[model samples]
Target: MSTIQKDSAITLHFTIKLNDGSVADSTHNMGKPAKLIIGDGSLSDNFEQCLIGLTSGENKSIELKAQDAFGMPNPDNVHYMDRAKFVGDAEVEVGTVMAFSGPDGAEIPGIITDIAGDSVTVDFNHPLAGQDVTFDVEILSVE
Candidate 1:
């Protein structure tokens, strides 16, 4: 029975729920468990700490604050772009998520939050930002 440690390779199923009790994400919906190595930058330190001593076949529910979960939404992440930039077939409507090239050529996903004349407001913040969340986890294996 291996306990989760700093370098442990873990396999688990997780369900992330928002404060409103709506499901945000779940490996169960994907029909497969997720695997990860601790301290690999895939999860925040606060999130990983919750699994410090957990072993196989354990079930745990962890509650996280807004800041700890995804950090509060940053106002700086909101930008106004020219509506003309959204040309072609894609519809330009509020609540639409679109990806654009970043400075490093990586795709940055932004959600359209507003549209006014030639100005389109795009928010780059994580969709779950500023919301407290709960993680329901079932540890399948730890090595």
Candidate 2:
């Protein structure tokens, strides 16, 4: 039974829930476990810290503050792009999620929170930002 530590490869099933007990994300719903290596950039350091020392078959519900989970939303992350930038049938309506190219060629997903006249407000903040969250994790394996 290996404990989760730096550089350890881990497989786990987890769900992210909000303070209201509303689920934000869940691998359980997807019917698949998530696999990741510790120290990888896939998860925030604060999130990964909660998994330390957990062995196989262990489960825990770890609560995190807004800043610790996803951090408070940054006003700078909200940008108003020209409606024309949406192109044909790109779904620019409010609540639509779209992917935009990042500086390093990564696909950054943004949500359209508002549409006003010729401006479409796209928020690049993580959807759960500014909300406290709980991680319900079931450790499947650790290596």
lDDT, each prediction: 0.96, 0.93
Tens-digit lDDT string for candidate 2 (17-118): 988998989998999999999999888888889988999999999999999889999999999899888897676689999999988999999999999999
- TM-score between candidate 1 and the true structure: 0.95
Please give the clash total of every predicted structure, in order.
0, 0
**Model 2 CA deviation exceeding 4 Å by range:** none
lDDT, model 2, position 42: 87
Estimate, for each residue in 3-68, the C-alpha lDDT of model 1 and write its tens digit.
999999999999999878999999999999999999998888999999989999999999999888
